[model samples]
Target: MRPPAQNPPTPQTPDPATAAGAPEPRTSPDTPDAHEPPDGEEAQVIVVGAGPAGASTAVHLARAGVDVLLLEKSRFPRDKVCGDGLTPRGVHQLLRMGVDIDGPGWMRSRGMRWVCAGRQVTIDWPDLGRYPDFGLTRSRHDFDDILARHAEASGARLRLGVKATGPVTDRAGRITGVTATGPDGRPVTYRAPLVVAAEGASARTAIAMGLERDPRRALATAARRYYRSPELSKDEYLELWADLRCARTGRDLPGYGWIFPLGDGRVNVGLGALPHRDHGTIDLRATLDQWLARLPRHWGLNEQNADSPLRSAALPMGFNRHPQYSRGLLLVGDSAGMISPWSGEGIAQAMEAAEVAAEAVVLALTRPDGPRRDQALQRYPAEIRRRWGRYYRLGNTAGDLVFSRFGYRPILNGQVMSRPGLLASLARLLTHLMEDPPRDTADHVLNTLVKAVPLRGR
Candidate 1:
């Protein structure tokens, strides 16, 4: 998932930690007109938070000749607690953003290795013309920096060390911009015609705009720590352990654990759980410690080799937040709760939503501020929900059933893992990697089934 707002360590060595903020900016009572901003003082779009969603949005908007302001609470080369695994879907987004994946520091992955119920299987990424048939892993410290710099180079005005406090609204309660606390610890106000909330799962700006998260939706918590594991560092497959159990109750967790090799003597070890309403309390940190202890000693995952502290954050699943576009404010990335429920992946969704939101904004800006512009802006959420709604609904149902009592074991037993065809199908389904018109019979059937599902609350 996208890392929550946190300050990282020195650029040379990235470390993840929580964040701090200051008071809101005060508006002048006798300023010029309320409608007009000072000369050269406003942007066409204000993007809060510089993670994948914000960076992607700013990059696309700048490429389209839109003046964008990208604000971040942290500087470049900062660490964001993440699994660091980029699937083919995410890779496609990076490639579209012109990121050099073949360059140094990018660890390529061949496929995925599943370990559960005393069964193991390796499934390679599908070979499809629509997507690159490979995955990659790079720490968020480097990953986010690359994206932010890329966006800046594309002409987006990126402001680091600036924390957005809240949205600045007009008399009608429509958001005009955001007031922030700059590096000087003083309040500053930035105005824009449109504001994008890419501020991760905390969703500060969206909440301020009165777009609350839907409590009926599923929410997951994830904890991750880095380790120096030479043995696994060069592995081509992204390893997933599905046999995780709760530390307190011995119940199966509703999520999976991952070991993503970074090809640099380091591996990101983490687990995420999408707990249902009745799902009891499970300590993610203790569960992570328990799982790591069971790994082979030769892997060197002990505390002595730990590269980072145990950092944990919430993964808001599905479209947990509503009305993605509200009163000139748009939600993207974790702010809209766009993380995948089945896979616990946020980068791909964030970037994809950024692209969609950028296009919508561009279209909206083409028209005057009226019903037509509002209609164009409203299409953003509808389009996003149309693309991912049914799939996530299916995932939520499966997670509820599969992560329950003896839920995961039966599915992962040798009986199901033995068949390569079935395993590959399962992989494609879980990762949401498929092309239209179908690559094969499996993809055809899968796409048909997903499309046939009755959609609700579009």
Candidate 2:
């Protein structure tokens, strides 16, 4: 008989001093007591938000020797409501950023398994033969702190407890900097040649800058919790439960429920739904509990196990169809709706966008008054669209279909599970297509498939 599963780690309250390695909170250069710059001064780039996207961008840019100022509305080690599941791409990006996620506390993962309608299927992520696994799991609280610390170490100046109130624009209507409210409640002005908006779903910065998102495209709410379950210790697969009939609606929403094991017997379990008034209104906690009640006996969870209080938030889906960059400004991650409409996964996309934006910012700074700046800024939105547009659009359409009453069954059995090879092929195609200056025959085939995929009505 198999040995009893190991108990997962208990959820602990976050301690910034211990986690972030800083005793005193860092202050922004715009703080009241900040040293005055000699008459004329400017920051090369100012990134708003200190979450994954913002911190990632700042780190990348600062590593390139560019002066970057990063502002966060909250202090470090703050909790971010999210699913907390990092895909292979997110892992790859973190490595590229010089983050050592596998050190001691991280929970590694290998693949994802889908369980729905009494059927189960698993997809093994492509192994380049070097990496240990496909992904890992960690709370946003610890993850964000790690990223922010990395940014600071790389030369980016981080300012916690500071909020950007509004953008500063030049006479030509181009963004010049931002006016922020510091922890002391005083308004301070920071001048930067370019600004990156990495704030999450609220998109306060983007909206303030006149970017409009299509409402219909925005669908999906998410709730999550960290649970101590001895049953998850040996479970390597990131499990997704697709049946929502167990909940109040008697019908599943466009999205599915997920259980991402964080190793050490802990797991991050959450549920998300595409926008439906009735479905959205359903009590998420009740639904989650209903699902949790049915877990297999071996997958250990009990009343005695310590579990963190549930956290919930809205997920902006179908928001990637539009350009996210404008003159003197760029948006990355959820601010730009970079979350995959199909998977509701944004961490990897956020990091990728951060890298892309960092490259553009570095190039733009070298030619402040030249056409190169304009060209660099212009390339950002277009490049992002080209890179993920087709897949994202298709994902939205697929999400719509999966959530609909009539379309769910066929998608589950016919497209996703029955044809695993097709799914693998698509994944490979997408990976190939996203490479710069697309390859030869593979690029042609991938482009054709992308075009052939129906993206209109579900």
Q: Identify the candidate with maximal lDDT.
A: 1
Instruction: Name the best candidate (by TM-score).
Output: 1
How far does residue 268 in candidate 1 sit from its true spot (Å)? 0.3
Q: What are the Cα lDDT values of the candidates?
A: 0.82, 0.69
Candidate 2 clashing pairs, residues 3+ apart or interchain: 8-264, 8-265, 8-266, 231-299, 231-300
Alpha-carbon shift of residue 367 in model 1 (angstroms): 0.6
Per-prediction backbone clash count: 0, 5
Candidate 2, TM-score vs. the true structure?
Answer: 0.82
Candidate 1 displacement at residue 44 in angstroms: 0.4
Give a tens-digit lDDT track for model 1, residues 1-458: 11112211111111010011212223222134555332223787899999999999998998888888999998788888899999999999999988888889999999999998777899999998889999989999999999999999999999999898877765435566777888676777787767899999989998876677887776788889999999999999999988888787888877888999999999999988877668777789888888888988998989999999989899877778867886677899999889887788999999999999999999988876555776788788879978887898887667667753343556677877888788788788889998877879878988997898778863
- Determine the backbone clash count of candidate 2: 5
Give the Cα error of residue 111 in candidate 2, in Å: 0.4
Cα lDDT of model 2 by residue, 1-458, tens digit:
11113211212223222243322212222323344322122477889998888999999999999888898999989889887787777888899999987587787777777676666777666654333347788888889999999999999989898888776654334566677787777777767767899888877666666665666675567898877886775577788776655366665555678888776667788887665444346577887888778887556554556477888986765554234666467889888888777667888888988998898877776763434576777677667766676677766666665553322345565456666765454444432223333444444566676667654431
Those runs of model 1 whose alpha carbons end farther than 4 Å from true positions after fitting are: 1-40, 404-407
